[model samples]
Target: MSHEARQARLRPTLISFDVFGTLISVRDSSYGAFERILAETGAHRVDVEAFWEHWEHRNIVHYCKPYRTYREICELSLEETFVHFGLTGDGRLINHYFDAFPRFFLYDDVVRTLDRLSRRYRLAVVSNIDDDLLALTPLQREFDLVCTAQRAKGYKPDGALFRYLIEHAGCAKEEILHVGQSQFTDLVGGKPLGLTIAWINRRQLALDDSVPRPDFIFADIQSLNDLVEL
Candidate 1:
């Protein structure tokens, strides 16, 4: 469907967001923090870029397993990273990421756009984080609903988290528009559940043909105000 037609059809009462890369800036900061940790720990031989990818891959692998808190998953991934690099690093080093994550800055447009959208629709957060961590962020705006992987016992890209969202959203699946940056998680998971998916293409990356396409695509959250007019 055309963008105009899709916009006209979408009358979502609840707008759900992906917290990390969508509303907040985490990727670059988290990588920088990881690099700092490597430097501080004296593991100068470990390549930050390679270690970042390996850690992320481990995290994603863990997501498919039964269930574990995000903190445990992070530590496990870090442990695996150490094993991969043949470095006897401290597992507690994962605490650095935990400490740094909650303080990560939000996207410049996030608060302004969320504030504007709040006047019309109920705003919700659906993230792959623990509640305690999420609460530490600047996003303590009394969102109408907050669903975390810790509460749901499942992470995104898996249908379990989105299923939890649909069950508690107090509305039809079609009435919730899930806006997120990750094509793998939000788009792949939410599309199968009947929720309208909006892709926030902040990086302007090309969509892979293997994944399901999003219902709407925007450069950033600020564009959502235009799509969901009052």
Candidate 2:
């Protein structure tokens, strides 16, 4: 069948969201915390760009390994970045990121859009975060199903977390529409399972050539209204 024909036939009963970049506004608070951590640790000479590249890359690497608490993974990734950059920073500096979580807010469009989407579909959040950290954000009250890496004992792009969501949701893969910002995690992990995928390209990033194209692409959560009528 043609791609448009295939999508036209998908009647999603569950709308699953990836938190962080998708629902909550965290980039500023997260990076601000990281910068504060660097200053506090006296890592003044560290290359900011290179440090994030190494740290985030290490996060993906750690996610693929045996499950660890998200905080542990963050600390490990940051500590490794320190070593990779010849710095003496403490892994515990990741606490700054955690401390900033309470300050993170939902995007202006999120609650109104979700409220509308919920009228027609069950809503859920599948995130790569510890449950407590997720609880700190406004999103805690918003989802019907909450699947976190801590509960799954694994992370995304590996499929364990997505599978956990599928099992707990008790629905056929075709009934679920998984929305996320990361091509590597959401598209790479959810597509192979037969779940319909939507790429919320909040950053306006180019779709990576390595992953399969998503069933739909949108600039924000509000675009979900295009998929389902309220």
How do the predictions measure up, each by TM-score? 0.91, 0.92
Off by over 4 Å in 2: 1-10, 45-50
Best by TM-score: 2
Q: Candidate 2, residues 14-43: lDDT per residue as tens digits?
A: 889999788887675577788887898798
Model 2 weakest 10-residue run by lDDT: 1-10
For model 1 the local lDDT of residue 142 reads: 86
Model 1 agreement with the true structure over 96-187: per-residue lDDT tens digits:
88888666889999888888889989989999889999988767688999899988989887888999999999998888899999887888
Q: Residue 61 of model 1: what lDDT?
A: 82
Error of 1 at 138 (Å): 2.0
